[model samples]
Target: MTATTRSNEPGKRSSSGRMIARVVWMSIKLLIIPVLCVAALIVGLAIGYVVLGDKPLSDVFDFNTWKHMYDLVFAEGG
Candidate 1:
């Protein structure tokens, strides 16, 4: 009946170790989800650019289109 009494049980020590390991594993999965989502979004955008070719992006960003959109959104009146 002493403090060293518990240390003598190998099964208890192994079970505690397993519990700690499971907590660490669950924390890692929780942190990985958001990082994985951002990575997927960046990769998806890159693939979209390549698949869409170059012309469409150029048209989307064209000066007249930008001016028209800007004017529509920010103009003093509709």
Candidate 2:
């Protein structure tokens, strides 16, 4: 019988599953940045409305608030 040699290098991953898992984790990390940005935007709007705008916290998230702002910015009186 002939002897065969199997190379087992140190720190080299032999399983394709580990590579796929690493790729999936990287993708998840990349997607988190945009989600965090949207969250920060919502928090900023809420804080601005409550502090600078002096509006109630409950009204900060109301649809009418944004609708009014949109209308004012696009007013036709110019």
lDDT of 2: 0.90
- Report the C-alpha displacement of residue 15, candidate 1, in angstroms: 5.1
Could you give candidate 2's per-residue lDDT for residues 1-78 as a string of tens digits? 999986788776767868898999999999999999999999999899999988899998799988999999999996
CA lDDT, candidate 1, residue 19: 95
In candidate 2, which residue ranges exceed 4 Å CA deviation? 1-16
Clashes of 2: 0
Q: Could you tell me which residue pairs clash in candidate 2?
A: none
Give, for candidate 1, the lowest lDDT window spanning 10 residues.
53-62
* C-alpha local distance difference test of each model: 0.72, 0.90
Give lDDT tens digits, candidate 1, residues 48-68.
Answer: 655765435545436786588
Q: Which stretches of candidate 1 lie over 4 Å from their true place?
A: 1-16, 55-78
Q: What would you estimate as the lDDT of candidate 1?
A: 0.72
